[model samples]
Target: MRKIFTTIVAGLLFAVPFTAMAQVNILACEPEWAALAEEIGGPKISAFSATHARQDPHHIRARPSLIAKARRADLIICSGAGLEVGWLPILLQKSGPQVQPNALGHVTASHYVPLLDTGAGVDRSMGDVHPEGNPHIHLNPHHILPIAAQITDRLAQLDSANADYYQNRYQDFAQRWQQALAQWEAKAAPLKGTQVVVHHKSFSYLIDWLQLRAIASLEPKPGIPPTSSHLESLLQQLKATPAKLILRTPYEPEAASLWLSSKTNIPALVLPYTIGGVAEAGDLFALYDATLALLLENANVE
Candidate 1:
């Protein structure tokens, strides 16, 4: 009888860890995807990012360690649209069979997103323009919702056994996210129709959502940096029209933003374009909150 009791307890100890260790292994190439994967994955997945909030998602270093992690990932998510054209290819080439997914096993989140440009009147002279529209669509919460849904679907595909649990979490998150969107819009309604200057064309979706007018861009053209001629022209335009605020990303050069702001007397509002870009932007919800906060703070009312 004692032997039977001892064996039963031993069995229970062995079974507990396996049940606890059932999390999925996922390696996201960017912070935004990583955040979504974690949210949709719930406690069933482990997601890691190759870059930080302060880093540019467009240019990342391909480290061997990262390749090893990629090799182990069941799914690899990227921003796509040639945004990671600079580095993701190298990681793809270096990732060994450990990470290689059969056509059925591999997933590219970009294919899940709607491409804007798709080589429409694309040219190199456009600075570093993505012939695919903008790869930075994650800047918009509406765009992010679909991506989150996609992540949830892939997780279900990879771990169908716990698919329902993942699905439930996704539905809950989406509902909450939608509610947050409504609230944010309500709070920011006052800023609608306000004119602002953006350093990059990255915020068209957000700008459109908020109904703000973009008076000028710091870049003379796509991929081109701010030049003396462009700055002079922008300052003149701002002076003529009087933009209320300057929306700039943290990854962008503050010098040009400062110069433009100082010249035009419009305060430059530095905002995080992605998750973890700032402490307040540590998560997806806070990200939108921070963005709205900045826009609302700077908006001009007549």
Candidate 2:
């Protein structure tokens, strides 16, 4: 009887440490935020992204599996400013109070960054224009540290015991990220003032950061699919000004950009707009590396 008692107590002691190591659950609205959370939270958190590289953040459906994840989430991270307007509200409604809007557990990356394309004259006629500005803020590497700071604060608040761990992680990530940013800027020097056309405004932040000029978009308006008439107009416009390259995300249909490229002799390139968008862009640093390499390869620098 004493031997049996000793064995049971030993088993219970062994299980205690595993139970104590339970991770905080994070439901990130996009893959970039999930990757960012992983950087800050390290092994103390389990981060999951609702949208993948090929999925359009603007149009995701709030499916039942997502609702299940939301219910279990200790925190939620997203790029706000109406980027996830289609489904985030529904997820918030079904999620715990901790992750509701304005809650400490709810972190919006855009709220911490200076947004573009804001102000009056926004209407449905504008075709999916975000009144709060462009939410593709992750494309600008400079915007990352601020958002990482915010995330670290939230992680500390959520799990005070691991606060120092998160802070140390953020500091290390910041140092490496800053070094990468400088290198990227130096390598991209030749791309400044280089004119290009785009399938959409998806890379506005990237273009703005690199000082590249966007001559035209395949789409006539935001979120609108390209039409024959609009493409013909863009063809005429480019004939006069002559853009160096045409850009599009992996998820975007290639028809419009390809058609334009065939006529103009300008190369159409697909940029991995987020983490996992391309095989090479497996992480945040790699995302910028791949982007700059692609631009430099095709750029007509003097």
In terms of lDDT, the best-performing candidate is 2
Clashing pairs in 1: 24-44, 117-132, 117-133, 126-222, 127-222, 127-223, 128-223
TM-score of 1: 0.87
Q: Give the candidate number with the greatest TM-score.
A: 2
The residue-by-residue lDDT of candidate 1 on 75-169, one tens digit each, is 78877777777777777786665344334334555666665545567765665666667777676677777878777777777677777888999
Whole-model lDDT, candidate 1? 0.76
Cα deviation of 215, candidate 1, in Å? 2.2
Question: What are the runs in model 1 whose C-alpha is more than 4 Å off?
Answer: 1-21, 96-107, 113-119
